[model samples]
Target: MVDLFGHAGPAQVLERAARSGRLPHAWMLAGPPGIGKATLGYRFGRWLLAGGAEGGLPAGSAPLHLDPGHPTFRRILAGAHADLRALRPNTGEGGVKRVIRVEDSRDAIRFLAMTPAEGGWRFVLVDGAELMRPEAANALLKTLEEPPPRAVLVLTTAAPDRLLPTIRSRVRRLDLAPLAPADLDPLLMRLLPSLSTTERATLGRIAEGSAGQAVALAEGEGLAMQALVDQVLADLAGRRHWHPVAEAVAAKRDGSGFATFMALLRGALSAAVRQAARGQGAAPWLEGRALAEWSTLWDRLGQLAAETDVLSLDRKQAVLTALLWLTPPRR
Candidate 1:
């Protein structure tokens, strides 16, 4: 289990809810990806299943701190727990499919309908629930609408806005915020032992409070890509070479590459905005109207990113589109 950071408020809120025996059937752990939304959900499940209230805040075994030796921990970790069912994206031989299909949701429904195998609370954790297709969401909605007795369902989503309004209404929202760079430093060091101090700091900045995002960025050559973005941005006056950077980003479109690119792009614009407002940064020259252009540029980048995600727009085209817009033909 990953060490959770900077989310004690949500944990206490959940603890109170669970201890009161009034835990909601559905909880939407809404937050940006790589934050501890899913981790907190699992911890809650562990706490509940371990009969946490029976122990009452014992030092070594707080509800969130179930020792690895505990039966519940072992059961969940081994996927041998009778009452817990977690559905994540299915990566099979065909390819890595992003959407969780309806069939799996039906299986969860069936699982919920059955009596708790051990006569305790049942839990259903849907990681990245936003990945559910329409049919899958509808199927899960049916279960959500009429949940089984002694059952708790948690749907963790990076994009809760994409969830059905009805689904959102049915569940209590527990939003998780990203951790600060200082809070994330220890975890980043553990995860990337070989990373230099400078590289680690860069990852923390790019992570924007998401330990998960930091790990992904560190492993995904984010520094290299960020270097490219910085170079392109610095060349704003010259408009020198975009082909190489564009091609490089285009090549990285498959997995975390696009995300790193977007993070870098957005971070660059955000820095400019910050620099303008605060007179910070070595190049805070974008003082007034020039600084104002950052927001417009940010919006343009965001629109392109949305189109790329929703429409599956060609990666190269998306990269080129962003580049052209960033360095538009000076009118």
Candidate 2:
């Protein structure tokens, strides 16, 4: 395992599965994106291929390094390994197809029919299992109903609710929670040694327990995002017009900075909600009518986060519009 930050629960489940032969034939690893679910799945596959031995597979055995150079590793990475198969969407036109077609699931049948390359266990990993179309999911259900001997199927999903009930019922479900600050702090320090203590704390606080997100914050990306969010909030607090800020943000529609900006808005909104929960005198940065407006904006932000296509909107524009709507009219 790469020890990618967070995923303590998933790591424990895999370890327990290795110790006990009672490991389920299929596992559903569900969690938010950038949370190390795929890394854990790969680690589990490596462990199984290596016969539970540590430090890579034995010589002459199928490569289990998770490195692209290894034969089996390449197969898994390229989605072409004979014994190991990954059920995912086609990489054709239309940008990843957005859904796993029935054909993709059907491919698993061929992989399952073959014997293990190393005469041990065959592994199938479905990254984003929730993307499976109805027909594809039905095809997958057949395999799950009667799994092959010495075979393991792992499904990783950011949205489990999108999956069929039948599929969810058959597999052993592993829920992964966000990583604690203690677990994330060390990783952030290791990844960004140059970060100041204040910066690190800010990132950790905004990460909301996601190590991947924390790293983004520590790397300065998140700060830039926070600045944009702060600008909008500050303008609203001053009773200033928001069109200029909104237009400025909308201009960078597809930039990476926009994504970070969205993350910052989410983090700030979360902080505001926590402050509101604590009642007055919670956050030193908030006071007077600013606190009242922030509390109201918190509810609106929560609703916006739940929107189906929130990600598709211009990052700055979306957040700015929300701020503008929440801002009090100038006298």
Whole-model lDDT values for every prediction: 0.78, 0.69
Clash count (model 1, backbone only): 1
lDDT of 1 by residue, 160-224 (tens): 99999999999999988887776678777887899889988888876677878777776788888
Output the number of the lDDT-best candidate: 1
lDDT tens digits, residues 243-283, model 2? 55555545553455555655577667667757677774354
User: Model 2 residue 296 lDDT?
Assistant: 70
TM-score top scorer: 1
lDDT of 2 at 256: 56
Which regions of candidate 1 are displaced past 4 Å?
Answer: 56-63, 91-97, 238-263, 274-285, 301-331
| Backbone clashes (count) for model 2 | 0
